[model samples]
Target chain A: MKKLINAVEDVVVDSLRGVAAAHPDSLKVDLDHRIVLRASGPVDGKVGLVSGGGSGHEPLHSGYVGRGMLDAACCGEVFTSPVPDQITEATKAVDGGAGVLHIVKNYTGDVMNFDMAAEMASMEAGTRVESVVIADDVAVQDSLYTAGRRGVGLTVLAEKILGAAAEEKRDLDALLALAQRINEGGRSFGVALTSCTVPAAGKPTFDLSDNEMELGVGIHGEPGRETTTLGTAADVASQIVEPILADRDFTASPVIAMLNGMGGTPLIEQYLVWGEIAKILAGKGVTVARTLVGNHITSLEMAGCSLTLLSADDDLLTLWDAPVETPGLRWGC
Target chain B: MKKLINAVEDVVVDSLRGVAAAHPDSLKVDLDHRIVLRASGPVDGKVGLVSGGGSGHEPLHSGYVGRGMLDAACCGEVFTSPVPDQITEATKAVDGGAGVLHIVKNYTGDVMNFDMAAEMASMEAGTRVESVVIADDVAVQDSLYTAGRRGVGLTVLAEKILGAAAEEKRDLDALLALAQRINEGGRSFGVALTSCTVPAAGKPTFDLSDNEMELGVGIHGEPGRETTTLGTAADVASQIVEPILADRDFTASPVIAMLNGMGGTPLIEQYLVWGEIAKILAGKGVTVARTLVGNHITSLEMAGCSLTLLSADDDLLTLWDAPVETPGLRWGC
Candidate 1:
């Protein structure tokens, strides 16, 4: 409730204004449509990459809008899916001579709206738009807002890899195949020590006792696999990593590991958790080729952490290492 | 207190293990001495940069140890200054043929301990060492841990600018003078909505009423200027910016502004605050040539933010734009 915001209704637009103001050289904001576009986007013959979802998980869809990442991001209200209109506008804005690719998370509202937007873009402008839904959270098969597994931490990885591929001027079909490959290979699990409060709600989304944690919690505070007793970082790491490895066998290929923070947890704790997880992976003989530890996809001020493991080949690793200059993720540029 | 930690005693070392694991290509960790060193360090004739302090303000000293930044960072227990021995070892480990420079915050323990380390390095190893102490916080003339002003957000900026300068093969004396100039040109102010709990303490460092906030708070939860009623981001922005601009004349030149989060605040809220701060700066005719908004320097999981503005000329701006490959900050590599 003590958030640094003016009014609840103005939160998304205001934050976008700040984003535009902060990255004037790289990002261009269309406030009226609530879409953030790359300042130098729509490469003449390259497929445009667009992704979006609810607002609270920052540095995700919007913060990733720049060269080598996302061409445009259609921002919705906090924890609410962007309307089809917004997504359509984002699609049209980033459409070059090549087709557009929509990288969407697996939420019912988001999936449906993005589909509608794709149809609208195709019908209105004859623009070919391909949609790739990311449902990599190994938490639950269904959640409060998602019919399938909720797209969690893997979305960030997918965006980075797909963005790099798009920057290489890969056709829409190839990008779609890569996106599906990433979705198939990536798995994520999250634990919430505390629930986040939406600005409009002005109260925590859920109640979690100090000694308890939500195992496999969704990004929007949806019910997880179980409400379990809170344990040490080692215990938490086992709980998170076991389910992820059980769901996907990472031993077959070199893995890219991401130990992501859920807003409220500090970097030191993230590193601590990563250390424990690394030990577990090493014991299991998982070869981690790349590791990222920070708050990439966060649930607004929720104290917890998530783990994402992607089975990566040399190609995926190369794409990940490619220069990316987004506000949220940057490297090798 | 809820934190993702193993044990109170192992927090620093365990976290360092994670850091070393996550950034094997860029960083090397010495667990016995609790020092994070650049994997490729002691560049033949470049002045080595060494900075260290307490452990809690992460990504401050430890995360900054990489190429184009600090050659070494000494890690102490949470909220406790690094021992002279640890600092001396770090100094020795990173001492190139040219010399070494120590960037110390203005905390009494940090300044004193770094000074002792410098003396030890000079007397015992015959290594030349120079020190630059940052006292940029305009919050208070003195605080619980500092003799003069508390070094807050400006340390990040100073380390960055000095790191770039050192990479250009600047000598120890020239880096020291540049550091002092940066310290004089920079000012910082912070606000805390809630207090953070040290792992050993198992409780909050300080308390504020639910409806109140600590204005001008230090990174260690020390008392601030006043406990004021919670206000909107606009109101808070005015309170933060007015004091900073009043204390210095940022209008004389372009400014590099950073709106930094204190761990627990969400990026959305930080951007919202930055939006408000940007409006105020524009109204005041302060030209911001560059801006950074995120959690760079943090106080554990304290829910608040701080702002640092450095007056910049063409030279400083160029250095600020230099490539930095730290875990906490990165661009243009």
Candidate 2:
């Protein structure tokens, strides 16, 4: 594998160190606990948003930490869940007088560990922590790294919208409701042009011919539900968007959509994909209110793209447009 | 060789269509001329900022066409400089009565085209257009795509800061002075871990072994000064920054630094590389007043990073901190 890393074992820590050095003003990295916390954390009377999963889907949990986003993000090893201790520490660290919310993606290990951490926080620190599981990926019902639907691009939308609400001092119950609303309202579908190499594995997670693509691929290089010959951006976009619209009725509200690049796809292709997705969505009588197109949630060096559509009411749209200052997604700050 | 495109020849136009569709609110595309013009273009009496190059280095030109960044950007085919006709149309479109500034990268074709466009604008539209060629890459004395130094990451910096200056009603001459100052003060060096494939070429631009890297590689996959074994991020960072400091004396003032990822490198790795670069700069007593870390000036899907440093005065820093609202770089909008 041709990765710019020191050693396989050192990948996560080394990367975390870099994260710390880059955004010294906005974030503070707890080197020992492996949690990225808001530099000025535990803001009194503000609900603390905490979310994390595997490390490879970058700018996801970590990059979402700052004003109007997560108060802390527990960084796990690549494609691996953070240990309960790490999650527990993060829960305590970000807790203000207002309680904490743990945004766990719907992966078996992540769910289990976050659940344990929430319970531990409640019992030991008496910090009321609520956990919401995100399962937005409409790929496989179950996958190699997940028990049910994988939490994919919706995590980004959820973080941005919910982070805004949290900044407004939304209570834990209200924030939890918003989280559930986002999870239920959003759906995601992904396609992979190439498999990403996990540093430890030192090889592509999977292989495909030049003409093939893995439809419905997961962020961790998990085997997609279907494999097929690659097609034009418009054709590929139709396939991905069809699965999403079939799974839900998004016409009830204007949707906030994201055409996120899996790490290696160039922006040009992503935009082209977005153009086709927009045309398709327009034809379906669906109006997209807010659009985010980039590699916001990405697998490490995986060549593919994912689409997330979240049915938005005025409230969610307002929250999404709210100022957010973070490493990954920053605007109006 | 794999890419998500329709016909190879349709890449640029299809991608521009995507761009025009995606950012309709902030930008309007001249479909015929292949220019990305600000939706509200050429404010009367305001200095117009125009830039462009080959299509692959995204967010460099098109993504930057918005309020406080660029008035317009001419789009070219993949890895090809825009023809003089396209540049000439863009010049006349964004003339704004005050004048137009042509920000051209130092590639031979780009320089030739922009020069010809400037003369055409003067003759046909009576628009005073001044061109500032950015040749910041300190990798090679000459390159395959360029006669002298290839413009790399510094073009982004110049556009951002100079755009702000122009937005504040800095006249053509002052903006030109600022641009020249920035071009002289800035330097960039890039390294490529893997070559990017131009969809039209249907293959990688160059080749590297699993353990090898191209040091000081140009944005368009031109050969660097050296090819060596892949090293740790710190070692790589040291290699990149050393030659830059040796080329000029940046100790007299605080520098603005950007650790830019060539499209394919993951954000985590980019931050890690930034961590190493920041440390080395600190050790060398070079105070970095501002830092930007991301794939702002990408080379298609090339897996690597580049470093750009510009000596910043208070005026430049103030302009740098000014609000910019663009698809690629947006802040304080």
What is the Cα-based lDDT of residue B33 in candidate 2?
83
Per-residue C-alpha lDDT of model 1 across residues B84-177, encoded as one tens digit per residue: 9999999998988889999998999999999999999999999999998999999898888888999889999998999999999988888988
TM-score of each: 0.99, 0.99
Listed models, DockQ each: 0.86, 0.74
Report the Cα interface RMSD of each model, rounded to 1 decimal.
Answer: 0.7, 1.1
Top-lDDT candidate index: 1
Candidate 2 lDDT over A38-152, as tens digits, reads 9987899998889998898888889889998889999999989999999999999888979999988889999999999999998999999898899999988988878889988
Candidate 2 residue pairs in backbone clash? none
Runs of candidate 1 with Cα error greater than 4 angstroms are none
